[model samples]
Target: MKGKLKKTVVLVGMMGAGKTAVGNALARLLEVPFLDSDDEIERAANMTVAEIFARDGEPFFRARESEVLSRLLAGSPCILSTGGGAFLAPDNRVVIEEKGVAVWLKADLDLLWQRVRHKTTRPLLRTADPKATLAGLFDARQPVYALAGITVESKPDYSIEDMARKVMAALSGRHDVMEME
Candidate 1:
């Protein structure tokens, strides 16, 4: 019951879960344009994400996220890396599911923490114990991510490039043809 196979690839995951990195690699591998939702928001807002969070708040940011996602879907043959919370929004999830191949980049809590700790401006992870914070975020968001057609478990031993290749392979019918690449 899937729609027509557009060449667009949408990557979803938590912040610092490497969506941008992996999406870039995947875009290069597929030779498509790579679009990062956060970057698009920054461009449209004329401010950094930290500035947006400090001045406008999360609801505002999410609204911008939805706007950017919609515009991205209007195009074709592209790879998009969405904000960590994009899929949490029902409307955004529906748009992505209908328009493109949604791939969830899954990572363990520890790896997520290690990747994100150096970042000081994650509004959600500003808690005193970010480890517990990340675990809670993961618990809350994992089910939403599961709605994606593809789930890629990322680990230290495997590079994002590796996962991107796997995604391509899966999409090319080397894996489950019934599933999205």
Candidate 2:
């Protein structure tokens, strides 16, 4: 059964944190729509995220990301998955705080690396030393991501369904965001 979703659930975390995968599962479990900010941006721009970052630079991409996020958050409640850096900006955080419930899919650096190491789609990880870059990013972003409304720890052993269920459980306590039937 679909429960009442009073606010949009925004999934935020590092690359390969399973935001898209887990958000899809969460949306299915909630019987709500699943939206990804990066996908939305890509569709509108008619370019992949990597291409956008490479061609237009991160600043331009971030502007588009914020625009998409604002538009989506203005719509009906759903499960929204954001890019790795979406929640880092203060402006984006303010809008998300006002319009949706930010949920950080917290995972250890090792787990994150294990998931992203094989993925070339991540533009940020295209550096010479991606592992070190990822570690630095993880260290810097942890404090910012901690500002989310909820935190769901993601372990290496957890499947998409498990993470989705964990996220659902975490949101269950927030009557403003979710209400179990």
lDDT (Cα, tens digit) per residue for candidate 1, span 2-118: 222355678889887789888888778766789998899999899988899889999999999999999998897688998889989999988887777788888888888889988
Q: Mark the regions of model 1 whose C-alpha exceeds 4 Å error after superposition.
A: 1-5, 174-181
RMSD per model, one decimal: 4.0, 1.0
Q: Residue 93 deviation, candidate 1, in Å?
A: 1.0
Q: Which candidate has the top score in lDDT?
A: 2
lDDT values for all models:
0.81, 0.95
Q: Which stretches of candidate 2 lie over 4 Å from their true place?
A: none
lDDT of 2 by residue, 1-181 (tens): 3468999999999998999999999999999999999999999999999999999999999999999999999999999999999999999999999999999999999999899999989999899999999999999999999999999999999999999999998888998888879
